[model samples]
Target: MVAVAAALALGTNAGAQLYSTPAEVTANPLVKGFTVSGLTLSQGQTRVTLDLAGGRLVGLLVQGQGAQEVARGLVLAWGGEEKNVADLARSLGAEEVKAQARTAQGFAEDSEGTVLRLKVTGSGNAERWSAYTSLLIHPDSAFPTTANAEGNSKAPNVLRVFSDFQCPYCKRMWDTAHRTWAAQPNVYRVVHYHFPLEQHENAEPAAIASECAAAQGKFWPYADQLFSRVEDWVPQPNPTAKFVEYARALKLNVGTFQKCLTSAAPRTAVRAQYAAGLKVDVRGTPSVYLNGVQMQDYSDAEEAALIRTVTAASPSAAQVIEARLKALR
Candidate 1:
């Protein structure tokens, strides 16, 4: 059988608390799983260890006074039972959780404390149930954006791009952006927006999937895998199954990663992003906006010209306002 040793460390004013008792945490009797074996709690820090033998790993760190309290009582506290890994991941912390896939064990931290979920698909498909956790947990940073809340500060031209993981058009535009604007130091700024269609169930899942991976600071790698699967039809079984493969390929904590995807928070976040796109006039995937000016043709020449114009003008906030007003007229 596959064996996993999960460790978590908590910190506070008192110092660090370490939990490592194998008996305190129990593995799922039917299928391999994890439980808190030992716990160390203090006013400043808390720690727990999960002996995940034949189970997937998921984790989170909670900060702040409320999180500290939660961490103190987490081992004794019981949350709702969730079959999906994502739900279990989120239960640890009340934040949105999304699932990712990886081959091995992984860990995460937030406001509450640190958590480690392991994947113990030890020997057979039957043993994989260990990956589906009954416990709860809740689940960062990649790609610097030149655009601020008001829009591009350097480029002044905000390229809001609506993209899909399964769309070839989106891939083409992504490539073109890299060759054109993304290569420049501070020429043009691009803000990507996700708009996975209903026809492509996998596209939305993939978007959430990548976001879940982002929880572990692996957004780009997750994006790369999703984009790589653009040619194929990612459906319930296929996309879900393939995500596990991708996680395995990336050596991610398969259990915790998968749980993140099936959680509510990440799903809500994806939906919120999509709703925000509607307000910005995204009629279709691969939509482009240059300085708030929608680009009808995503051709190289048109995109390049727009880039050159914005870069040369280096429009100020007032100038950008004027330009946008002129377009309205």
Candidate 2:
């Protein structure tokens, strides 16, 4: 976390409230299988997991001690669910920790906060469910973007993105998906989260700046400026002053913004958002969740394809949007 404040900011959702609780999610006739997230599991650590059919969720679970292993696990899990841990790790064409080859329990939740405890009791030919370690339960509210995550509020389709300010790929997603679908306020909503990558030296500070900008209702504008000029502040040893300049340029209250910077609040908020991203298995920056089904790719092509697929498969309006979001959430 940055000592002062995060450097970059995100947006305000201009879209509709759409589905939050489970009742709002109806079955998606076109989609087969489902991913039930917020299923709390422990590996000496607690993590929110997506429950897939056939005990496949166990395969996607990551093992080991380091953050790098966790990240690698997420990348592999993004490939798709596997029958067991072995398949999950090796099938992705990268070898990591092998599954513990043991029985385990997990849990899932519904809209009303009902908890469903599950277990991977058997193994190999007799395997009932493929699991690595412990299982637990959590609330449905654990998912979904924060209220500050901004975009079109009236739109039925809520697109949540976890992004890094310095990531070029993230910028591409903003240009292609955000600006495009966001243009249609009635149909699409956007919620943004910051996931500054570790390698991006200036990413955290940039996030802090954007967060401060948001405090004064200049989030989107400040974000735009930061994105447009990543090179200017990225290489600086300390972009703190440059970030304040962005505030000044945007006519934000420099005094309050500066004060906000000196406090740890903005940085804490930004890191909280980043932690939220990890809980949902965000493997990479610019991870786009349109209506909560992560887009396979962040390009305009995937965006169009996802929109078309979701639109066609969904019943009248974007009701399926809620279903998908609920499933992923």
Candidate 3:
């Protein structure tokens, strides 16, 4: 088995601090009557140890930390058939059994339980079959902030966005919020993270370029230009030149921007952000989170409503807008 250790740093809607450590389990200790079987020599298994309560898996237990329970939810993995998996979830108190698309992941929920399931198919008939399940006690806890994020760092309300520069939907969301909520730094803080889909060839390069621009304190504007003019450089043979052009237009030091682009720093930073997205179970581009709660429909209006809800007791909208406008200058 490939053994690797990493730390997962997380912050909540209430600004509570949390972190994750590598966890593993060789036995089915938490779930009673659950048996471990269907093992193949080649296809090994890795299970994250978790704590259960009231017929539902509640929190995870890391080595150094005492029972790091999830206030929102938990991700669980099970190896079995569809009916067996559903039955097990039901036994654990999951109510609705909504079967999603055959190839897509599925989810079922109850009053205080939500479970995300992904059916795993092994190589040929010689491999073992399994299903990975995420049992969310609090669904909102699944969304976390990126490490090197931008925007109002100290703002209580965090708008964590996982985006690809070349995604049309992402661009639409960005355009919708650019002038309103994103501009209002006092109402909500926007945190940017990279989720470059493999289909978008230029997306990763653009993400790296934006990180390089961030090194010069111009990530927001550079990202704006990237999304606004995606078609311009996306089809180019060497988009690095176009990135440089954008940097020059932004009045950034051309030499530094160019150097940062080719260097390992920007690439490493983008990779880390991508890893962070994966760790939080991001399925696609433009995955948005308002204060650690995943946004179902990513629209400017929806984002505004969430922000208002979080900061309801704070300053009025007009006052917040005025402060945001002043901060811009």
Clashes of each: 51, 27, 6
TM agreement with the true structure for every prediction = 0.46, 0.56, 0.53
Tell me which of candidates 2 and 3 scores higher on TM-score: 2
lDDT of 3 at 135: 24
Residue 293's lDDT within candidate 1 is: 40
What TM-score does structure 1 among the candidates reach?
0.46
- Model 1 misplacement above 4 A: 1-157, 232-238, 307-329
TM-score of 3: 0.53
| lDDT of each residue in 108-182, candidate 3, tens digit only | 222111132322223334322232222222223444334445557677676778899999988988888645666
Q: What is the per-residue lDDT of model 1 for residues 217-284, given as tens digits with 9 covering 90 to 100? A: 67656676777666553544557777778877888888989899789866776776677656554667
- Taking the tens digit of each residue's C-alpha lDDT, what string does model 2 give over 1-329? 11001011101110111111122221222112333345433333324333232222212333334323333333322221222224323332221212322212232322210112223333344433321211111222545445445545666666777889999998876776678766777776667788999999999989888888888887888988998888899999999889988899999999999989878988888899888877765778987766544554656463444344433342522342233334423
lDDT of prediction 2: 0.52
Residue 120 lDDT, candidate 2, scale 0-100: 33
